[model samples]
Target chain A: MFGLIGNIKAVPGQRDALLAILLENAGRMPGCLAYVVAEDTADAEGIWITEVWDSAASHKASLSIAAVRDAIDRAKPIIAGFGQFIETRPRGGHGLAAIAPA
Target chain B: MFGLIGNIKAVPGQRDALLAILLENAGRMPGCLAYVVAEDTADAEGIWITEVWDSAASHKASLSIAAVRDAIDRAKPIIAGFGQFIETRPRGGHGLAAIAPA
Candidate 1:
């Protein structure tokens, strides 16, 4: 499975607003197996998003979806900057709908 | 929910070995909602482990499990070093067994 783990830095005091948009947009996506949004305990303005998708193509396709695009637009202003973004190949784990074949 | 996202740098050419130990240890842990082990696309020696647990206490308790301790001891040799470790409070997302109360 395709995976992404990244940190998003929200403008000071806008973390909640940014988080709200993210959660609001976290709805039905065809290949999304897991989409977690969390508040970074160390950084007041930081948020972490961990995503697992069936394929890279599916992840890319989700970007074109209206709701996702809208969320991006709405979140742009408060998103101060991005931190480490790591693309990954998820092998398998608990809670995943399906595990990537070896 | 409590969450952890971090990078582990394996000794040169030991990534697969380290990965094997991790996967081997990924078994039934009471409050572990998700435990994903992934290969870092950009760094050959880097691995990412994203974990979501029912609570901070649950996460802490996991460290005492014999299997977990054994995995850590076995992985220590090949684990060259560590990178960013971020603690988080997960809200809700797809694929998680249960959502944290708002």
Candidate 2:
């Protein structure tokens, strides 16, 4: 599976606002195996998102969805910037279940 | 629970070697909930690690373990550098089991 890990910084005092918008419709995309939005402990304004997709193409296709597009637009104003973004191939983990591709 | 998401870069031509070492001793960490290592699809020499620990204190204490220390030393040479490092507070999610504190 394809994985994405992103580090996001929210505009000062807008962390909660940004997080609410992000989590509103997260993980609704097809082929999404796991999508987690978490609060950053070290940085008060930082947020982290971890995602696993069935494939790279599926992940890319998610961006075009209207819900995702809307989320991006809504979150734009509150977002300060990004830090580290990386992609990876997910094997499997203790809590991460395996699902066969249809 | 506490979460850590970090980006790692492997020395050129040493990605596999680095991955092997990393996976060999990973998840053996005390208080560790989930530890996942994946290869970066974009950067051939890049790696991403996602971890969930019972608490920040547990995570901090893990660094001093002999096995963990040895793994760090062994993987240090093949490691290129770090990218985005962020700490987060994990709630709960699909495929992620919930465990009570000791």
Each candidate's DockQ score against the native complex?
0.69, 0.41
- Segments in model 2 whose C-alpha atoms lie over 4 Å from true places: A26-28, A64-73, A80-84, A91-94, A100-102, B25-30, B64-70, B80-84, B91-95, B100-102
Q: What is the lDDT of candidate 1?
A: 0.84
Highest TM-score: give the candidate number: 1
Reference-based lDDT, residue A100, model 1: 26
Specify the poorest-scoring 10-residue window by lDDT in model 1 chain A.
A93-102
lDDT of 2 by residue, B1-102 (tens): 898887789999998888787776555667776667788888888888787777888889888989879989999998889987767896544334344223
| Candidate 1 per-residue C-alpha lDDT over B56-97 given as tens digits, one digit per residue, 9 for 90 to 100 | 998888889899899899999999999978899987676675
Error of 1 at B70 (Å): 1.7
Q: Per-residue alpha-carbon lDDT of model 1 for A37-96, expressed as tens digits?
A: 999998999999998999999889889989989989999999999998889988767666
True contacts kept of each: 0.73, 0.49
Worst 10 residues of 2 chain B by lDDT: B93-102
